[model samples]
Target: DASGVEAVALALVINSGVTLVKTIPLRRFEDAVRFGIGLSPVFTVFQVDDQITSSPHIAGPTGDTRLMPDPSQTVGLVASPGWALAPVDQLDQDGEPYPGCPRTFARRMLERLAGHGLELRGCYEIEFFLGHRAAPGPDEADPTPAHTGPAYGAIALADVEPFATALIRAFEEQGTGVMQFHPEYSTGQLELSVPHSVGIAAADTDLVVRHTIRAVARNHGYAVSFAPVVFAERVGNGNHLHLSLWNRNGRNLFQGGRGPEGMTREAEAFTAGVLAALPALTAITAPSVPSYQRLQPHRWSGPWACWGRENREAALRFVTGMVGSRPDAANLEVKSMDPAANPYLALGAIVAAGIDGLERELSLPDPVQDDPASIPARKRRSLGIRQLPASLTEAIAELEKSPMLREAMGDVLFDSFLATRRAERDVFEGQDPEDVVRAHRWRY
Candidate 1:
C-alpha cells in the first residue's frame, strides 16, 4: 500500500488459459482490499465465443457470483506507472472453496508432499521473443523478427541491451532473483533463468517475472511474445521447469551416490512417476494447439518421455551438479512445458505425480545415454521409451483416460479443465498453421 500507488491490478488465472486482469483505481483499491472483489462463476467456463455456453455449470438457469480477496504476491512495477499485481482467489457464492482454482490445487499438493517430510524446490526457465508489433496484413500474423544472427551471439544480446537492463532491474525490485539471461537459438528470442524457490513461491516468482518482462518491454516500445512458436520456421519458445525435492531440515533429497547417475532413491522414484505420467501431463503443461508444433524431435523440446543425464532431447533431463555447487545444484529439468501453461496447475500436477511415485515406491528405468532419436527404433521400443503426444488432440485424449491425474485434480476441476481445452481445440483445429500461431502469439 504505497502512497504513490495509482492502481492495483487484480489478477486471476482463468479457464481460457491466460491471466485475466481487472484494474482498480487507487481510490477504490483500499475498498477492494478490505471487502474483496466480486467475480462471476461463469468465468470458470468461459469459451472463446461468449455466445456459446455449453458447460454443465452453465446448463442451470440461474447463475451466482463470489467475492474473493487479492492475496499478497510479489509487488514490482516501479519502472512503469504506479501499479502492482493483486492475486485473487475464486470462491462460491457462500464463500466456499472453488474447485477450479489453480493456486488452491498447488497449495494442496505442497501440503501432501510436506506430509511425507519432503518439499518441492524449483524455478521456471522462461524463453520468449521480442519484436515490434506486426503491421496489419491480410493474414493478420505477428510482426517480423527484430534481429537475425547466430544464437547466443554477442551482437544479439547487445542489440537488446536497454530492454534487458530495464527488465533485470524491475525483476530485482520485485524480489525475483535473476540467475542468467542470454540470446537463444531463434532470431529475436531470449532466455531468462531465475533462482529457484520452495513450493508456492516458485510459481509466484514466475508470475512476477512475466509481468516485469512484459511491462519493461512495453516501456521500451517493444512487444514480447511467449508463444510456443513466434515464426513457423524458427525454433519455438519453451518454459522448461527445473525441479528438485528437499527435506524440512534443509537437505537436498535428489543427491546421493547410491542410485543411477548419482541420484538418491527419493529422486529416482519421483522422476519415475513423472515419466509414467508424461503423456497425460502434456495436455496441461503444453495447453495450446501451437505447443505441439514446438515438441518435435531434434529441437530439444523433450519429444520423448524418457529420462537421461544431460540429454536435452529427453522429456526429463537429470542435471548434474556444477563443480562448485556440488550436490546442492543437482535437479531434474522437465522440458515439455510452454509459457501458455498456468504455472500453478503445471507445478501442482507435477508434484502430484512425483508424490504418487514416492508413495508407491516406484522404480526408475535405465537412463538414456545416447540421443534417443538416433537409437534404433527396435531398441527404443524395447527400452520402453515412447514419443510424447505430437498433437493437442492426442494429448487431450491421453488426459481424458488418465484415472490417476483425474483423481489428483479432483472431479470438479478435471471436468471444467477438459471442457475449456476442448473448446480451444474446436476453435483452432482446422485453422491455417500460421494463423493459429498468430492468434496465440501475444496472449501469453
Candidate 2:
C-alpha cells in the first residue's frame, strides 16, 4: 500500500466492445493472479444497452470462466490514485484458454502470422468528443461541446491545453508514447496517436490508452464519448488503425520494392488481402448499430471497397510516406474502423485477412484517385469498386459468410460472435438513427 494501491482492476475487453472488469484489493492481487478472478460466460454477449443477450453455445448462468492478469503490463492510474489496472486473459473452468476470449483469438492469429516470417506493427488512433450534458437526445441524454472554439483552431487547443497537457504527462508516465495530441475537426473532438508496436502489444496499448483517457477526462470534469456517432447530423468519430507489415528483422515490407508505391510483392499481396476483406472486416471494425450512422458516403469514413494512396475516402489508405522517411514510414490505414470495435478482434481479424491474401498471392486492384462515391456508378463498377456493408445487418451477414474469418476465429468463437451481432441487429431493427447515436454516445 505504499503507492496507495488499495485496489487493482482486472479488465477483459469482451466481444461486444465493452471492457468488463473485476477488481481485487492490493492485498489479494497475488491470489487473484495466481488463481484468476471469477466471472460469468454471459458477458460475451452483453449489448451496448447492458442487456444480456445469448448465443447458442454460451447462455444462462451455467458456466464460469476465470480472468488471469498479465502482470507485466499492469499500469498505475495517475488520474485515479490508489488504483492500477491489468488487462486479463480469460481462462476456462479447467484453466484452459477460454475459447471466447478475443485476446486469445488475437494471439493465435498473431502467432500464425509470425510463423510465416511476417508481423504487423499497428496502432489505433483514439478519437472522442469532449462535452457536457446539454439536453436529452432524441431518446437519451444529449451533450453539447465543452468548448466554443472553431474546429481544429488555436482557440480549441487553448481551451483544452491544460487538460491536454495533463493527459500527455499521464500517458508518458504510463509508458505510452505520445506521437501527437490535438483538437480534431468535430466540435470538441480530440485525438491522440501513439507510436506503433507489434500487433498484440498495439491492441493492448489501445485498451490502456482508452482507459487512461476516460480516467483523465473525469478528473478534468469533462465527459468523453468514443462512440462512432454522437449526433445524427454531425460528422462523427472514426478511430482509424495504422499498420505496416514487416519481416522479423524489423524491415518494412511496404517500402523499397517492385510493387506499386514501393511495396514488395508480399506487401502488395497483404494490402490486396485487406482490401478484399473490407466487406467482411467492417463487421469487426464498425460493428455497432450507430456505426452505420458514421459509415456513409462522402464523409471520409471509407464506406467503399477499395484502397488508395493518401485517399481518405478509400477504405484502406496506403501511406507511402514522404521522400526522406523511406522504408520505415510506409504503412496502411484502415479508415472504416471506429471506437466501437474491440481492439483485439479488429487487429486480429485484419491480420488474419492479410495473411490469407499473402498465402494466396493476391493482387492489388488500381487505387482510386478520387472519392469512390464521386466516381460514377458505371465507373465504380468498371473499376471493381463497391460500397462496403452499409448497415450492421449487412456487415454481420458478410461476416457470417467469411470462411477465412470463421476459420481464424475457431468455430465456437465465430458462432458466438455472429450470434451477438445478430442479437444486437434485432434489438436495433427499427430504432431511429438519432436514438442509436444517443444510446452509444457514452457506451464505450
lDDT of each: 0.81, 0.86
- Where does the lowest 10-residue lDDT sum fall in candidate 2? 133-142
Error of 1 at 185 (Å): 0.8
- How do the predictions measure up, each by TM-score? 0.94, 0.96
**Model 1 residue 100 lDDT score:** 75
Q: Which candidate is the best by TM-score?
A: 2
Off by over 4 Å in 2: 1-4, 134-141
Model 2 lDDT, full chain set = 0.86
RMSD of 1: 2.1
lDDT of 1 by residue, 1-444 (tens): 454678777777765568777777767766775556776666767653342344654433355544454445636476666887766666666667677787778888899999989988999999999988866555675675656757998898888989888888877766676899989998889999999988887787777778778888889888888888888766899999998888877878777658888777888888889999999999988888888889899999998999999999999998987866746898999999988888888988999999898888898899998888999999999999999998889999999998988888887777877887888898887788888887788778
Cα lDDT, model 2, residue 316: 92
Residue ranges of candidate 1 with Cα displaced over 4 Å: 1-3, 26-35, 48-53, 58-71, 136-138
Candidate 1 backbone clash number: 0
Candidate 1 accuracy as lDDT: 0.81
